[model samples]
Target: MTDQRPQYGELATPEEQRRAAGLPPLGEIPPVPPMMQLSAPEPVAQAPNPGRSRPVDRFVTIGLLAYGLVNVVITGLSYLDLPTVMNESMKILGIDGEFSNFAQGKLWGTIAAALLVIGWALTAALAIKRLRRGKVAWWVPLVGAVVTMAVVSACIAVPMFNDPAFMAYLEQMSGG
Candidate 1:
């Protein structure tokens, strides 16, 4: 007759358990305890990654630094003379002087240049603080910087190219 016994697993040979329990070699058996139960606790939940969304803050910081540097350079040129600042701005913008003189030009030029510096510094400081805290404004400071830069660029370049009245004011300031 062929030997017949219940198998537990690969590790438990059919005859080994039968022999250990003092049962018949082939087919005789009685009830046995469960052996394959796991003792590990269930897994705990985890928090999601916070940095995966809205990944543009670093670029904003870099752009702020660049804008600050450009404004500082322009402000230094303004100190030299109206002609130098005007000539350089014009060349950079690929436009010609429509200014009657430098007085009005200098007034708005200085204002815009100063705003650029101040805005850049403020925005950079806020950005660094936010980064340190592991937070971002996502609206106020970021939008404010972008809008301020646009206004400053317009104030510096538009008058010399498209706005004749503002240009005349600048030329007058230069003469005075």
Candidate 2:
């Protein structure tokens, strides 16, 4: 019978197998052209600077600061004139007789106005501080401004509306 078992070195390596099969050696093959090679990876772009503020950031910050300053000024002025305005408004509403004394109503109104001014001032101050530090979210100051305006409007409106006479006065003024 013929020896069927192969020799140890008969197919030891791929190169030897290729040579035995009459194929060309790997070194004799031509290399692929440059165009056939994958184009060099495009250079990566530089990262943006984090320290610089965008135009939108600057716009929001400046706008909030300006609005806050205006709010503080108006609130301060209103506080200073609270008593006179309150007395006049009460007189116009024809409910001056409800208070035992004019001074008492004026005193309470002054206190309310002072409190409102102080609250608004504090909010504005905080928003301004955050904006200066470049750490405030745009919405923070915007929401604060809206809240302050609403409170101020309510402070003026609630008392005026609570007086039954004031509602009647409005009705008469509007000829409704």
Name the best candidate (by TM-score).
2
TM-score of each: 0.42, 0.44
lDDT of each: 0.60, 0.60
Clash count, candidate 1: 16
lDDT string for model 2 (17-110, tens) is 6677787888887998875566556755433332365446656756876777676677656655554565566686565333233343344456
**Cα miss at 175, model 1 (Å)?**
32
Score candidate 2 by TM-score against the native. Answer: 0.44
Task: Please report how far candidate 1 places residue 45 from its true position, in Å.
Answer: 18
Worst 10 residues of 1 by lDDT: 45-54
Clashes in model 2: which pairs?
Answer: none
Please give the RMSD of candidate 1 to the true structure: 15.5
Which numbered prediction scores highest in lDDT against the true structure? 2
